[model samples]
Target: MLDWLTSAALHAFGAPTTWAELLGFASGLLCVYLVVRQHIANWPIGIANNLLLMVAFWHVGLFGDAWLQVVYVGLGAYGWWRWGTGRVEQRVRSTTRAEWWWLAIAGVLLTVALWWYLDRWTESTVPGPDALTTAVSLLATYGQTRRLVESWWLWIAVDVVYVPLYGYKDLWLTALLYLVFLALCVLGLRAWREQLRTAPQGSPAWSMD
Candidate 1:
């Protein structure tokens, strides 16, 4: 079963596309489409996408990204529960100044730390970009769980870097997937901003808590 899943499904961009990559691509596209529509089902679909991409990335020796997929599974579960809890205050909102500061600091620290670790201990040839994208992705996912509108901005940044990065790694299908994610992130940002604009006047649009 593992062999069959990992075997080449087809050729694309001169690279052999595996069944895992194909499945990951489909699920990932659906996950982001659901996210743009503000549907809660994106979380579960994202978890499945993570599992498929983990195998695809590992096969290509993108160890950092492969491990990132494991972390995504945990984050996806938290997001699933958070979105489904029916909390009145869990509406679309801007990130508070403090939250922005914290996320910026975390992004910098995580990128540096992951770069060092991946360069020194891992076989990743593109450790710098791999680490940077991984850190940004984690931050974006965390912000998404809180329903913060800025999460889409971070995703947009990551997707821009990811497209070329994956292509360089010969994972053409995954690179194309990020291209689609780039477009979806833009739509998601606009949709969430509209949600915030039309929210009740007294409701918080920016939350410090």
Candidate 2:
């Protein structure tokens, strides 16, 4: 089974797709799907997906993304704790206008900072774009943990950037996965909007200072 899973027959766009990539792809997809449905299970499954992709990205010398995956592990744990209450459906909340402003500010700053770090400290080729997406993804993950509908919007932006980035690395399978992620982000946004209409409504105003 292991050999079959890793066989060259599992190829995409003329590139071999390893069993690990396939596992990460499926796990990542499922996690996003669950997130869209407002399920708490996405956290653990996303961790699994991130771990698998961490190995894949590191092997390809995308150290920024590899490290991002490791960071995602702890973040996912925090998200799990934040969103996975006994009455989980009740705890889900949306981001406020003020939070969006702060998140955007931080996203830009972190992107610039990470770009500089990756360019100077690492061997990353697409440092600018990689840093941008990675930074936004961090904020997006936090937004999703808080059940913010705008998280899906941020994910849409990140997926658009990630597809070509992965393709440039010849990770065609992962690139295609991001395309699916783009679609899912749209659906998640719509679903979460409807959810906000009925689930629970509260201000997400928290100090960013």
Candidate 3:
């Protein structure tokens, strides 16, 4: 598994091109679009994006990120189903501002644990940054699935860290893509906030603004 994954990364990193970068770029745009629009289709599209990124990052030996995409595939599917079922959104469970502190603490603890294990026990090169991104992303994905309205904040924080990390790794295209994602996170937050405000508590469907 290591040999195959490593070889793929080497091949991709060796020849990073406009087309490969654009695939990532376009997917990022579509994801943010669907997210801001509150469309259930976003998850399936997100799954596709993750699969593309899995190959792209794997070829570059960003093992943590590469593997992260694989996990996202599952999460994306779960998110899609959760949204489709209309349970969480119907609940309209907005977290208190205090919950943000809890999410921060959780993000920090998870990042520390992953960084330590991946760096110390494994042969991960950028484990600290990689694990941190993955941890924040986990929270964001969970929040998103549950329609908790806090997901965008988590994504904003993650995107800030990701821009520099991807740039340092010479994933210039991805770095640029994240800039767009940062903006989208802000938009998504506002959009979802409006969604929650007008939506009747315990109602299932959101009206388009």
TM-score of each: 0.94, 0.87, 0.82
Best by TM-score: 1
Candidate 3 weakest lDDT stretch, 10 residues: 2-11
Residue 96, candidate 2: alpha-carbon lDDT: 81
Specify the highest-lDDT model's number.
Answer: 1
Q: lDDT by residue for model 1 over 115-173, one digit each (tens)? A: 99999999999999999999999999998888899999999999999999999988999
Writing each residue's lDDT as its tens digit, candidate 2 over 16-89 gives: 87776778898989998887776778889999999888877876778888899988999999878866543233
Checking candidate 2 for backbone clashes, the offending pairs are none
- Scored against the true structure, residue 3 in model 2 reaches a CA lDDT of 50
TM for candidate 2 is 0.87
Off by over 4 Å in 2: 1-9, 86-92, 200-209
Sort order, TM-score high to low: 1, 2, 3
Residue 73 lDDT in candidate 2 = 96
Candidate lDDT values, in order: 0.90, 0.81, 0.77
Over 55-140, each residue of candidate 3 has an lDDT whose tens digit, in order, gives 66766657778788888899898988777776455544577778778888998898898888778876677898899999889889
